[model samples]
Target: MFNQAESFPTLQVLLYQGLKKITVVEMLKTIGQDIGPSTRWTIRQDLARHSVKTLTSANAKEITAEGVIIDREGNEILIRGNTVVIATGTRAVNDLYERLKERVPEIFLIGDAKAPRKALEAVAEGLAVGRTV
Candidate 1:
């Protein structure tokens, strides 16, 4: 079991078998959720069944032909894979919003394009916008 207690506020990812499955777990002590031993054991068993390799506390430094180069507690670990999926949260790129703002006087921007946040926030924003409209 790879403990990611050192890196907080960063996402720790586990890629299984050449991009067959990707599991993203947040490594923030303040915001992290605790998983019981049984749950962890079950997860391990499932991964083992599917031949999924788990890399813990891995901070991706770069992507290379070998796979993703990660920094784990100062030691570099390379995860070999044919496919790599990088899930970097949401971003607010309001190119369309800016363009439409001139043509449409009243416009509401919702979701990640407006602000990169949780689905709950986006859903709340959507409901608020819907009520206004």
Candidate 2:
């Protein structure tokens, strides 16, 4: 969505998040490179460069007839938009392995299949699986 926003000539992109800084889980660094630190700065700079407006410490409380009501620092802020995109994060479901394990001879649980993670970790797992295969 961030990449797509750049193509719009007159579009106003607003990103609202509950957290002040976007960060990756600390445990991710133990397996691979230290990408956690760079993510915050990189995202901040990229968003600014692309003219994307961001509201930190702001969470959507409700959607009324007027606009989206955001709770920011104990204050209510109304955000009006033609379109609303909600990104609530992701959860990993490893149930497939349980059901297929009885039928399948070989099973390789990798990436999100093992647990929820970033693209870098997913790609690393994919590469490792490919090499093993």
Candidate 3:
């Protein structure tokens, strides 16, 4: 009964209609054009196909997202790598990282399990960790 392709647009429209005020804050300076050449093309194409508009370099404060507070500024944005990947799961187990580090010379911990954070932080950490691994 729930088709993602059909439901996503309906959900977006509902959010727009239901919310009296809505602001989009994109931490990334460039949307869909800075990941990499190929990825840039894909993102650009997808955005165009979906008619999604994005605002870049927007600073937000006092934000309650998914029941968590987010504080961000333009200067505080971290862009160490040229790619984006999402890794989602339960909170990171401290013992897992420590135990793995003991058994393996190269071990890196990432995402909310390492510390509860937004998807953006997790993605950033994953990218940083992936480069080392």
On TM-score, the leading prediction is: 2
2 or 3: which has the higher lDDT? Answer: 2
Badly placed stretches (over 4 Å) of model 3 are 1-24, 64-95, 99-133
Worst 10 residues of 3 by lDDT: 79-88
Candidate 3 accuracy as lDDT = 0.55
Model 1 is weakest, by summed lDDT over 10 consecutive residues, at 24-33
RMSD of each: 12.5, 10.6, 12.6
Question: Taking the tens digit of each residue's C-alpha lDDT, what string does model 1 give over 14-131?
Answer: 3333446554322232112244565666766666655655555557788899777777678877767667788645569989998899898699999888988778888999999999
Those runs of model 1 whose alpha carbons end farther than 4 Å from true positions after fitting are 1-51, 118-120
Q: For model 3, which pairs clash?
A: 91-113, 92-113
TM-score between candidate 2 and the true structure: 0.55
Q: In candidate 2, what residue range of length 10 has the lowest lDDT sum?
A: 23-32
> Which digits, one per residue and each the tens of the lDDT, describe model 2 over residues 27-128?
122322334775767765665555556665666787777667877677888877545566555688899888998998888888987888888889999999
